[model samples]
Target: MDRSRTALIWRYAGRGLLLTPLLFLLVFFFYPLGSILQFSLAPDGKLDFAAFQQIFSRPYYRETLWFTTWQAALSTLLTLGLAFPAAHVFAKYQFPGKSLLLALATIPFVLPTVVVATAFIALLGEDSALNGLLMKVFKLEEPPLHLERSLKIILLAHIFYNYAVALRIISSFWSNQSQRIQEAAQMLGASRWMVFYRITLPLLLPAVTAAAALVFMFCFTSFGVVRILGGLKYATLEVEIHYQSLSLFDLPTAGALSVIQLMTTLVMMIVYTNLQRQMTQPLNLQSSRQVARKPRRWAEKGWLALNLIVMSLLIFAPILALIERSFTLGDGGFTTRYYEQLQENPHRSIRAVAPVAAIQNSLEYAFFVTIFSVLLGTLAAYLLSQKTRFSRWLDPVFMLPLAASAVTLGFGFIITLDEPPLNLRSSYWIVPIAHTLVAMPLVVRSVLPSLRAIKPSIGEAAAVLGASRWQRWRRIELPLITRSIAVGATFAFTVSMGEFGASSFVARPNQPTIPIVIFRFLGQPGLANYGQALAMSVILMAVCAAGFVLIERLNRAVIGEF
Candidate 1:
């Protein structure tokens, strides 16, 4: 009777704990989303569809939407074309420095979009070192590369940012795929290309399609890259939303665009999720050790070396260029003047924060964002791990933030939280709150699998032995999932450190984050300003790199999920 009563109590307690994440979603996610809809559909408290009508009727908005679609499609195709062969190499071979190469490939995916854009500009901008070298060598008066602020640059940046998503997904999936079928086909005298086409291609379609969908979603909503590299010519929905809401103060139109983007991404997420579920279904899986081998033939060695060189150039060249350019001057001398300028505030501009101060502010914000995200996201994971009806449907609801654009979330925060009880427009906590919202989805995704993998029998046995619920959780469940929690926390910290789109809206001018500082420096003219921007970007990149390294050390097996 006592055990039964205890079980009942624990069950109720678990249900109550589930409410925490729901309340968080209500106040932060759903409330803000509702406010956006309300503002757009019924500004001045009267029903109106003019915003929607304008978006549909206007050629500019139509062209923006069309451009957004085609660019995303092109990026998806280009990334797949480049990453597919690389994925094959990573999956089917054992090479020296393989682990390090894979890790380096993934770093770009985690970097801030602003940093990615900055890296490209440092490498290919008219005043860049590459251009300068070419001009000097060829005796040309003008820079040969005109890729800056062009569609080509935007597409290139997207490829750089998203290459890892396809590579990791496909490689990880392919590594486990059984070789028996292919081997059997080869025994029957099929050519290598024929085997790949007839057997391997069909099997890999799900992973490739899923990767394509996710890459499309990211490029479709791209803001920082388009805004920085595409200049005034290109505008994705995310950029248009930012322009309308913040620049023009057209809250209604921005909200409409947000709704359109939100619906589109939600559909893409659904497709991706379904495909991922297909990937997780039972299969005749094989270990990488059984499938992968070192190159034995000269031809194989040459192909491997060629792929490695291409991957290295694609992933590392821009970063190296950015680092070198940060320390280089027009006079062909290297100096630390740019780094030194980070500490001084010569202009004393109210809108500008010192780079040193910005760094400090980012660390503090990241700390709190990590705490909030871990607590809330862990709770959400716990809730979703249960077998109850409530948990089943709630799983996708928790993932809604992943589908929602960060820019839209920021705009929603601006309009929704202006009242007395929830007023946080100018509060210090606002930035952290917004960041927490963005980071929590990642935390939930990282921790959920670990929680669900825990056998219920162990917890039942502990309860049967008179172990209290809290004691069982603290002693057994906590230790078992600590690594997963750490992974989530690290991701949250990294994400908070580099977040730009949402930060642009919520971060105060006087207390800007590192990305904001970099953006400001980039917007200003002169070589000194450009150099400072590069310096700040390098600092942010280093922080993100360190965080990723910690995560890599924590669990290499789980990094693929990221």
Candidate 2:
């Protein structure tokens, strides 16, 4: 065929692939969001702001908003402080087990909120084994600890979940900086602290700001963490949304709160995105092989040691406690009954599925979500890298679902699909579709950078040599972008696996996910239930860890080969 016809065919094929994501987003995201707007505006076919008025008039709603803001701010500050030093260490040094340590640091961030809450409770609750051990060590007559059901506990969990965000974003920038600037600063009689404050810290400010904004937004909209650990006293906007929607059935109030929350999040994202754009600069280095020749003084060693210790305690201890509880017996012996009990059907409980079935459900949903999200995300990323106006506009629109809370989105889905024209409420597809909405942004973000890194000339060269479009993409683009696709798929898998908010709203009674099952077990007050929760948590962690490792291996095989 002539070049004109070949180009035409290629363009149409590309459009077809790209249209899939747009269609998916339109049906699941924009349609549901439109439904939410309609619900909030019209009650009985009349336009009203009663929902907004009710939310504003109530002191409880105001309190929830205020508490949520403060808690999220505090958590962001704490996470940044802890993550800065760790990021610096990782960026500057080539330590043993560096990859493994980085992986471990991220584990807590990806685990289900319910699992993290339960793990924390297992380690530090009033009746926990740690409290018992402390009591014995101190020779006290009673266990004296009250960590659970406190605002502090909630804040700590937020920090644990988000520190990786600060670390990764800041450190990625940090690794690209030229060490010679710091060396020159040192040679000019600048102290270590002075160099960091005046040079390193200033350089990292953009990424730091972006990371903080994201973390703050996450904590502000937190539901599962606050619900499980914050008790009734510490309700965020998210928890309030949940209460208004589910417990009180006050859709108007919930809808109003969700709109406000969505507005606030969008504002934050806009401001952060603008700031990030302003601060973007060319990297001094692109490779991670760059080394800092500065010797590790005693203080630096101590700092590393302290960070390692803190990470172990803060991230791994709770997970270890969960595993221990899963195996510990009431009579102080090891047992496997918790795992065994998972084989039993959960229908015996209150409107719950079998634990094994929940696992199956979660895995199946995760698998589909991963596949769909990666495909859409990859296409969007590829289009965006072409730097077309159409892709730029579409890019931010695609990310809107991420800014909205899952609770808000779930409510939107519920209100939108309650009727006949396009009913999706009772379908199994609802949860996976919601999950795809949630996971797509992550996939796009992961793949976009890698796509941009591939020079446009490579594809042009193939076309000039009379190579077919399919052969060019298959032999060139696909090989280059496969690792990114894998990374995006891994992220989607983990996000869907641990997802709860949307799942809770859409999950069928007979098809509960693992997180839902764990939440159920935690609600009941029995050894068997608690053990089962811990055991399920362990399995959830294992699933996430195994997925992560597989992705890492893929990265090594494909991306690392370059």
Candidate 3:
């Protein structure tokens, strides 16, 4: 009877742990989101659907809405088609440096969109090396590769950003699938194409759907890439919102856009969750390592080489091009002039910031974001790893920030946090707090997998061996959780560093981070400004690469689908 009471008491105590993160999220995330809903829908102390009505009735808003949907849909399709074969190779084959290659492919996922835009420009822009080569080869006066500021370029960028998501998610699911079914089909005289068409592809549908929904959501709310690369000809919902609120100071229009984007994202998030859940439904949980082997046939070797070359070109060419452009001068001579200017802050009057100051600010913000997000995520991980009554439903709510537009969150913070006791309009801490909303989900994802892997028998064994509950935790749980925490902290730092969405809204003009600095430079004219943007982009990529290297080096034992 006493033991039962003690267990009951501890269950309630464990449940009480959720309150901390819940309260924090309520204040920072939910309250701000609610504030945006209120501010837009009821601007004059009265509810009205006029803003939404205006959006549908106006040609500009209607076009943006249509473009956002179509672009996202097209991007999703392109990404899936491009990524499917790569995912297949990763699942079925073994290769040297496979893990490193996979990690390299995933680096783009963590990069700021501005950085990616700059990289693409460096690779394919008019004066780019590839264009130089093409011009020389074709003996043409015009640059042959004219991808800049085009819908084609936008789709390619989306493919680059989302390639790993499809590869990882689909491969992870595919690797666990038993090979016997496919082998049976082969033995029954089915052609290779027939086997894959009827058997392999069908089994991968759930994961494919999940990846598509997620990729679509990302492309839908895309702001930085479109703003930087889309020029004046294109506008998505996110771009429209940015222009409305920041450029035009049209709050009602921005608010309506935010609401529309939020609703769309919510629907996709639900779809992704349901589809992903279906991916883990009990099946033959077999390992791929035993089934996977290296290529031997000529056709197999050709296919493997093709995938490798294509993936490498897609992933590394932009980065290499950016690095080269940063050093290349007017006469095509190598110079460090652009990098040298990073310290000068020469274009501050035109919104350009000192690169060093921006780096320091981003690092400082990332530091606090890591601390706050890890703490909140640790609590949430505990709730998820245990048998908490509400954890199942609460799990997806924690992921809302991942799906929500950063611009919307930033705008929400602007209106909500600028008044009353939460007057954080000028507070330096606000950016990191805003960043924490996104970073928290990363930490939760990183930590929860390891937490869930803990066997109950380990604790029972410690108790039976005369260790106190606290002692068992100190000697057992803490060490196990520490690895995940370290990785989670790295994730938090990376998220905060590359975060442009929330930072776009919260970061002050003069006190901008690296992405903001790069953005400001890119938006302006002149060769010097463009060169500086490339230089800063290289720097940002280096920082992100280092962070990803750190993450990969850390305990990859902590595994979960993000």
Candidate 1 lDDT over residue span 440-488, tens digit each:
9889888888888889999999999989888999999998878889999
Clashing pairs counted in every model: 0, 1, 0
Q: Residue 344's C-alpha lDDT in candidate 1?
A: 80
The TM-scores, one per candidate, come to 0.95, 0.91, 0.93
- Candidate 3 clash pair list: none
Q: lDDT for each of the candidates?
A: 0.91, 0.82, 0.86
Evaluated at residue 519, the lDDT of candidate 1 is 83
The TM-score-based order of candidates, best leading, equals 1, 3, 2
Candidate 3 per-residue C-alpha lDDT over 1-562 given as tens digits, one digit per residue, 9 for 90 to 100: 9988997887688667656888788998899889888877998879988999999998988988999999999999988887888887888789999888999999999888999999988888887888988888989899988888898888888888888888888888887889889889999999999998998888999999999999999999998889888888898999888888888988888888999999999999999989978987987768889767898898988898898899998899987888998999456889999888877866353455577788889899999999999999999888777676678778887888887899999888888898879999789889989989988988998889888888999999989998876688789988988878888898898888888877888898878988888888888777888888898888888888888888887756556544
Of the candidates shown, which would achieve the greatest lDDT relative to the real structure? 1
Please report the TM-score between candidate 3 and the true structure: 0.93
After superposition, which runs of candidate 2 have C-alpha atoms over 4 Å from their true positions?
A: 1-14, 42-47, 139-141, 179-195, 283-291, 346-348, 454-457, 464-466, 557-562
Rank list by lDDT = 1, 3, 2
Quote the positional error of residue 302 for candidate 3 in Å.
Answer: 1.6
